[model samples]
Structures are given as structure tokens and as C-alpha cells.
Target: MTAELILKLAGGVPAAFAACLGFGIVFNLRGKTLVFASIGGALGWLVYLLASGFAGDLQRYLLATVAITIYAEIMARVQKTPVTAYLVVSLLPLVPGGGIYYTMRYFVSGDTGMFIETGLHTLAIAGALAAGILPVSSLVRLYGQFKKHRLAVN
Candidate 1:
């Protein structure tokens, strides 16, 4: 996209990294696991930014989630650890916390329109995140099973 978009996304990368790193530390992730999980957050944000150039917010989130899930799966496989640890930490940047806050704010202020709008948007984000995770995770499991079956046959 434009240089402005690139610059903004670039700026966001470090923030995403820092946020994930903080959460990873809180989750008791240490050493390389923590570092790679943080990097996965940065990578997810970068993918979201790049996808934002051509996609709607939901699409961007979906694509970014896909990217992060793939990264988490790969990293988990390489590190021989559970994928949930990396996936959860890496997805912190995209969790739509602000949407939920504003939805609540609107509800409290008696603004039904904004409340409904923001609430729906927030729900959509949660749905998109779940939808994004499902396919990648299922495929990974299926692939693992297939490989195992092949190994057993041989």
C-alpha cells in the first residue's frame, strides 16, 4: 500500500511484539518460547496491516489470524511444545478489546444504535478469530494423523 500505511504498520510491529512479550512473560513462557511467541505477534500484526491494504477489517483479521496460526503451528512443531501456548499469546494484538469497551460504553450511555453496532462488530471479531483458527488447526491435525498413518504402514 502507501508509504504512510507501511510506516504505520511498521510502527505497530514493535508494539505487537512488546504486548505479546509481556503476556508471554505473565504466562510463564521462558527463553526461546517467549521470544518466538513475541515474534509471532509481530508477524501477525504485519500480516494484518498488509492485508488491510486490500481487505475489510474482518478479512484482515481472518488473514492475520491464519498467518499467526500457521506460525504457531510451525513453531510448536519445531519446538515440540503445545501450540496453544504460542497461539494464545500471539493473538493478543488482534483480540478486539477496544470494540468490547466501546460497545459497553455505548450501552451504558443509552445509545442503542452504537451499542448494537459495536456489539455486533465485536462479536464478529470473536467469530472471525474462531473461524480462522479452526481450519488451520483441523488441517494440522489431519496432516499429523496422515503422517502417522503413513509411518505405521511403512
Candidate 2:
């Protein structure tokens, strides 16, 4: 890989590590919990890259959502806390804040064409992420239900 790519990867790693660590500490994670969260974040980034490689921007976002959601669910199970806490950090990278900002800037400047384009792009990204996560969330719920059913039968 080129130096730029290496730098980008490195930048992502530390940001993810710090985000995960912060989330873990805030949520009272102990022992190996911090390590796990950091690992999850790193792995999530890798998943994002892999998914992005095989698809377009929207599909990439969707794949990232699926990866992050799975990571959050697994972390919740391990940490014995709600998934929201970890998810908050896990989704830091995927947010469309920059897109929204640019869109608004273009709108304020009366650049209707650019504004519309940016807005549409932002919505498409959001839609892809939502679409990707919905299935994972549904699967998790279904798995939980199956576990419950098994327990009830026994």
C-alpha cells in the first residue's frame, strides 16, 4: 500500500482505539473489557474496508452498519450492559455529520444544485446504513427468541 493509505489506516486505528477505550471506561468496563472494545473497533474498521472494497459507497455504509451492529450486540452480551453505550462509540466513524454540514453550507450559499446533490448523497448513505443494520438487528432478535423458546421447552 502507499504511504497515504498507511497513514489513513493508522489514523483510523487510534481514533477507534480511543473511542472504544473511552466508551469502555465510561461504562465501567473492567479487566479485559477495554481490550475487547478496542479490538472490536479495530475489527469493525477492517470489516468496513473489506465491505467497501466489494461495493459502492452506499453498500459500504450498509456493510459498516452491519459490522458495527454485530460488534455492539456482542459487546453488550459480554459487558452485561445495554448496547447503546458501545454503539455510540462504534458509530462515530459512520456518522454523516460532515455531509450534513456541507449540504447546509451549500444551501446557505444558494448553490441549489450542489445542495441537492449533497443532501441526496447524505440520505442515501443513511438509508444504506439503516438497511444494513435492520437485518442484523432482526437476526439478533430472532436468535434471542429462539434461545427463549428452547429454554421454555426444557
Candidate 3:
């Protein structure tokens, strides 16, 4: 990576953290929960930045989503709370808000081609998020179920 890109990524991680912290506050989170959730957002950004070297935009989104989801799952258990708090806040950095905005902008300007491209890209981002979350969540649930069944049998 170029020195400038590295500097931007460094700056971005903290910005992502601050943004998530603000969102967490809006979500009524406080103390350690807020801090950890914010860190998760920074982690997502860091992963995305790192992946930029060898991955496509969609791949970066997928990697970032996976990192954030895993973080949320772990943090939820660690904090003895629901995953929504961490997952929602942490994922703010990776959400396709810009894509959606640009898509709408193109639509409003009668640029059908750009609108179609951005809309499809936005959909693919959503798909990547879902693809990252589903398998990990399924595995976690399956592990919990199998453990519970084994204990009951014992």
C-alpha cells in the first residue's frame, strides 16, 4: 500500500470507531458495551483496509462483514447480552449507505446506467453481508444445540 493509503486507513479506523460509538450512544449503549462495539467497527474497517490490497470491493465487504459478525457474536457472549447491540453498531462502517445514495442520485438525474450499476452493487453488498453472517451464525447455533443435547444425554 502507498504511504498515503496507509495514513488514510489509519485515520479511517479511528473515524469508524467514533462513528460507531456515536451510534451506540444513540442505541442506548453505555460503558464497556459502547466501547467494545465501537472497537468492532474499527476492526471491520481495518479488515476492509487490509483486504484492499488483494480483494475486490465485494470481497472486502464480505471480509469486513465476517470480521464484524464474529466480533459481535463473541462480544455478546462476553458481555452477557444480545448480539444486536454489537452487530448493528459494528456494521455501520460497512453498510452500503453511499452506494444507496449514489444509486438514488443517479436515478434522480435520469442516469439509468449508473443507477442500475450502483443498485446492483448495493444489492451485492447486502448479499455479502448475509453470506458472511449466515454460515457463522448457523455454525454457532449448531454448536450450541449439539452441546445442549450432549449435556442432556449425559
Score candidate 1 by lDDT: 0.94
Which one wins by TM-score: 1 or 3?
A: 3
Over the stretch 28-102, how does candidate 1's per-residue lDDT look in tens digits? 998999999999999999999888768998999999999999999999999999999899999999999999999
TM-score (C-alpha) between model 3 and the true structure: 0.95
Ranking by lDDT: 1, 3, 2
Number of residue pairs clashing in candidate 1, backbone atoms closer than 3 angstroms, sequence gap of 3 or more or interchain:
0
Instruction: List per-prediction Cα lDDT, in the order shown.
Output: 0.94, 0.76, 0.92
- Best model number under lDDT: 1
Misplaced by over 4 Å in model 1 are none
How well does each candidate superpose onto the true structure, as a TM-score? 0.94, 0.80, 0.95
In the range 1-154, model 2's lDDT, one tens digit per residue, is 5676577678877777777778778767666656666676666676666664467877777777788888879888977877766566566567687999999999999999999999999988878777867888899999999999999999
In model 1, the clashing pairs are none
lDDT of 3 by residue, 42-99 (tens): 9999999999889998999999999888888999999998888888889998888898
